[model samples]
Target: MSESTPSFVSLLWGTLFLRPYVFIFLAAYLCLATRHLGLGPTLLYLLLGYGIAWTSEFCSIHTGIPYGLYMYIPATHSQELWVLGVPLMDSLSYVFLSYASYSLALFLLAPLPRSPVSGHPVNTGRYNLATLLLAVVLFVTLDIIIDPLALRGYRWFLGQIYGYPEAGIYFGIPLSNFVGWFVVGLVMVAVLQRLSHWSVPFPWLSWGQSRSTNDGYLGAGLYLGILLFNLILTFYIGETLLGLVGLFIYLPFTTLAILVRCHPGFKAN
Candidate 1:
């Protein structure tokens, strides 16, 4: 085999072994998305999401358009995978993150059935402009907690994978980064909405048969899982102030989500 072949294999396996958390979340996303959106749509979202995310990162490093200029450190290139200097896992993360955000938005915006016989109150994953925009907002909100702590990755197990040439205001992250996330979320959800209309039938790939009443909550739970993971890490690394800020930012939204679940008015048909 060629020398580059081994390196590529190593990077692919290393990315999964080194960053097990990303795959764990990805697994959750696959299950949740396939159940609600069908395997065909989920796979399409995964492929398209990765493409958009990788292209965005590739462009940002070179041209500083959407996310401004930020460079991957490539410190772990030999140990993990680096696709053109961007960590493979980094762009791959956008797939699950955007899906989780979109799932949660659907849970909140769609009308819930009052009957207990049906699955969880989250109606069929529907999309409107309001839902799409809310998903974008949620996608950006996740980064509000994630990016700051990630900047301090050197202090934790994440290692120092990337950095910005210039310092930023919010926990050393730039406003442009969030703006880029917003744009990505918007684009992703909009595309997903369009894809939902396509007739790409994959009946054999369907995994929704084992559906549970609790399935509706899984997507939102995945969102919370990621949010709490970052928040706990923020505190673990002794960033008490930053952790508190994240909590404060999420408190009202969490409250609203809870109300959406429990409120009788929201259970309207």
Candidate 2:
């Protein structure tokens, strides 16, 4: 409305799209996800993920039922965009995190049967109970590293943007926060499954399909990419012990996901 007021496009770009790693992850997800779902569905995916993350944060901040009593602490001199006291970039990051986790679950649990109609080893059962459950677990495992490092944002460049009134058990993070992540992560994957029509079979890969199956290589890469970024930050902030813990927690699982994905004999279907 005002001449100096930034447009929505500029705000989104400046607040989220311009960030170095966030921008890279967002771009990597779009490129990787589109290979399977195409551009249209990918757009829907982004919308669904953003909606679930923002809504959950809004609810938890107000009610304290899920994520506990945490409040936004806007960093001094920071011009980042906030939606109802929640960082826009924070919500946007969930889109990639959820997608990568969901994809990894499918890679590990979902069987890719060679469709009778199409010879490609495609998956149409991503919404099955097994896949959903595994995705939820992976998402939480990620937060184990995320919450601690994020809490130290002030010591690094992320700044002090949020705080929990009550101290938590794990590095000052509440148990309810992880529980909330599981709930929110479930909703994110579940919504994408229903909207994307998970039962609809699509082109997967050839018998000699590249080792990098959508669920296997690219998905796992994104998951690791996010983890490594946080771990680097942890060390940068002088939390060597925390950084090692993060590496210990994430490296083995990431290695296994890639191994399971790349194995030609791994798919039951």
Give the best candidate by TM-score. 1
lDDT score for candidate 2 against the true structure? 0.75
For residue 33, what is the lDDT in candidate 2? 76
Model-by-model lDDT, in order?
A: 0.83, 0.75
Q: Score every model by TM-score.
A: 0.90, 0.81
Say what the RMSD of model 1 is: 3.1
Clash counts for the predictions, in order: 0, 2
Clashing pairs in 1: none
Candidate 2, superposed: residue stretches over 4 Å from native: 1-10, 16-18, 76-78, 110-125, 198-217, 251-255, 258-269
For candidate 2, write residues 49-103 as lDDT tens digits: 8988999888888999678879888652135567878888888889989888877
Error of 2 at 221 (Å): 1.3
Which candidate number would show the highest lDDT if scored against the true structure? Answer: 1
lDDT of 1 by residue, 1-269 (tens): 65554567777899899999999999999888777677888888899999999999999999987998998887787788877878889988999998888778876776756446664554554657888898889999999999988888999999987789998999899999999888888998788777645565666655453455345446888998999999999999999999999999998788878787688575463
